[model samples]
Target: MKYSARLRLLAVQTGLIASLGLGFATLAYSETILTVALAANPQMQTAAKLIGNFEKKYPDIKVRFQTLPENQLRPAVLKDVATKSGQYDVVMIGAYEVPLWAQKGWIVDLSQYAKADTAWNEGDLLRPIRNLVSYKGNLFATPFYGSSSFMFYRKDLFAKAGLTMPETPTWNQVAQFAAKLDDKKAGVSGICLRGVPGWGQNLASLTTVINTFGGRWFDQKWQPALSEPESKAAINFYVNLIRQHGQPDAAKDGWQECLQLFSQGHAAMWYDDTVFAGPVLDQAGPGVKDNVGFAMAPVKATKASGWLWAWGLSIPTTSKNRDAAWKLISWLTSQEYIKLAGEKAGWGQVPPGSRTSTYQIPEYKKAVASFGDLTLQSINSADPLRPTIEPVPYSGVQYVDIPEFEQIGDFTSQQISGAISGQVTVDEAINASQKKMTDIMQDAGYIK
Candidate 1:
């Protein structure tokens, strides 16, 4: 009955197996794989978590993230982009790089993509943040989140000490408060600040201080000003404040270390990025969540003293997967993504300062009640174009917008960090940096 029947059945089974294998291969081949470089911050971490939703929505596109700490992320992406290596289809960059990269044609104009995608709601972005990420009105990148510097103080500690913290304390007052609140015996420092050396690390905080003290990186004439009286005063005050009453090993502390210290109740106050308010008041465990106070960035001579910044996503000109990259970017930066983040992670953890609509969400406003209004206020007040009280040729608060600033800020931060570590005096550090700046400015033709 069935030798021929058995042979026919075996052939049918073999064909079925081959058909299934071919179908799986076709699926794999059709799916687009995008390599994205991301900064290893909390929001970006949440983005990595939520990326699965994007993959689910577009089953044909797969995203692979290469996340690194802020210090490492900058150089790795810069090297790849500068060499046109095409290793990364997308990279996380800051507002500082946006204009320069756009001008150089290193990154492609994203305006067309944003224009085509009407659902993305490009106009919903905050005006200040939108301007910062654009060059000559052409968008080269989209901000994942925007931030400005502000102060965080422990209200319980302030009350216990019978001290009334002002809504906008001056730097001098902050120093006095630090002196009073500093309790070394109880394992608490008065304040926590970034001391780790990097352009975006310690220098970011220090630059704002310099600005408030009525100092500019360069005068209108483009002369070096690091060793000028106002600049020196700012540097000395910062270095002295940290050495005297800042967290121990202050020289070794960056934003992450400082956040850890403040969140662990080891510091009475912290002056840092407004983004930290979320982690401080709600997300970063239970340190001072119930007793934190929000205030404007401590001021000196200027009416305000905060720096504006944003971490953004951009496509390099060399990227082959531009469409796929833009798909990922639009998805991450859209209002829908913000809502998705608020739902999946806490509303407190949603990326902030980018969209006007983010603040309007009822849940988000409630979740960040302590800092929401003030965060928006601070971001709006920050003027990167007119960063310093005195006129200067540059247009950055935490950084300069030139390509050489990477080298300049890094070098200057190292010298100032030496002052913080006691390896060099304030005068020595400033003098060395001023000399270096003079040479750089002259060589770059900013000065004769």
Candidate 2:
């Protein structure tokens, strides 16, 4: 009986030890998953590549990316943060949203992270982009890529047509060039432009056109100006140009679509973010890379015509994994990562306009020598404080900075898109946009 009891005790102890070992193993191997929400753009391609390196470096953290279109990303992220849903740990947002969202207590103040890290090199960031993403001297986000608008054209097509493009073309001159270059039967459109009905899609480029035409979103008194003569004329010119010379189904095209069209030789000219110069110049792509030319964004009434913008990463206040999120943001935006991307993805693909050091890279300078100077000039000259020819009550080149501007810009873009599709007259669209802006401003107490 004593021997049998000893065997029973030994068996029980072994079983307990085995169970405890299994539990400890599970705890040790389990990883923390970080969910990131980002826009589906070419920059995200570089980000995806870096993520492999990130995971290799930090094996305990797993990342899952939620990529959405530009039009869809803003609403999805806004809903997630506004409701404190905690669905996204990291979000890619624009400079326009950083200050506004920070003010609403939706995003964490990233100054802490910047200050805590000795190697972050916060001063390396371009001053204009840094200021745009900061609120009252506190950093709210880290810019991944920054850009200003410029014009891209086919040098071969210009040569064949016996036409010469100017260094700074006017909108009127662009229209004349478009009329001469348009060849519908040859499977080419004269120009490509964003026509998608979203504030950040079509209105991003359109707002700059409005500014260059001497139109402001709101007057000094915060009164809506869409129905004013200058605003109406700008809208008319844009809609007519696209309808006459732009690609088929132009009303549905946004940045991605326009990029594809221009890259594939379906369009003779494109006016968009300068960051696209890389993709357009990519040797691996089916683009007119060898014959592409650059010029300043077309202007009418103002010399400072380009619009400034930055796509950045931020951690929401509701994030459960703030530490890991900051780690990812810092790594992706670091000078080291820029060098990695240049070496791996080619020097032309490095994200520009964010770091002054990027321009100093010898390889990058040689790679982008064709248009680097022009890109820097455009970015440096864009003054958001005085974006429009007339004085305005806002501080953005392609957008109004207030929170209410999102809703107003969205509603107004839908109306303007209707004009592009011929479903509504330009006058009708402008009137509707004006009324909506007035209502929003009045309700927000920006106007009585």
**Candidate 2 wrongly placed segments (more than 4 Å):** 1-16, 283-287
Taking the tens digit of each residue's C-alpha lDDT, what string does model 2 give over 1-448? Answer: 9999999999999999999999999999998898999898887777886788888988988999999988889999999999999999899999899999999999999998999986879999999889888999999999998899999999999999999999999999999999999999998999999888888888988999999999888999999988778887889999999999988888899988888888888888999999999877883244487888999999999886999999999999999899989988898898988998999888877989899999999999999998999998998989998998788878999999999989988898898789888999989998888888888889889886
Best by lDDT: 1
Candidate 1 per-residue lDDT over residues 1-448, each given as its tens digit: 5999999999999999999999999977797889999998888998999999999998999999999999999999989998999999999999988888888788989999999999998999999998888999988898999999999999999999999889889999999999999999999899999999999999999999999999878888888788778988999999999999999988889988888888889999999999988866654447477888889999899988889999889999999989999999999999989999999988877999999999899999888888888898899889888888888888898888877788889999999889999999999998888888888888999887
Best by TM-score: 2
Q: Candidate 1 — number of clashing residue pairs?
A: 0
| Candidate 2 Cα deviation (angstroms), residue 117 | 1.6
- What's the CA error at residue 363 for candidate 2, in Å? 2.3
Worst 10 residues of 1 by lDDT: 279-288
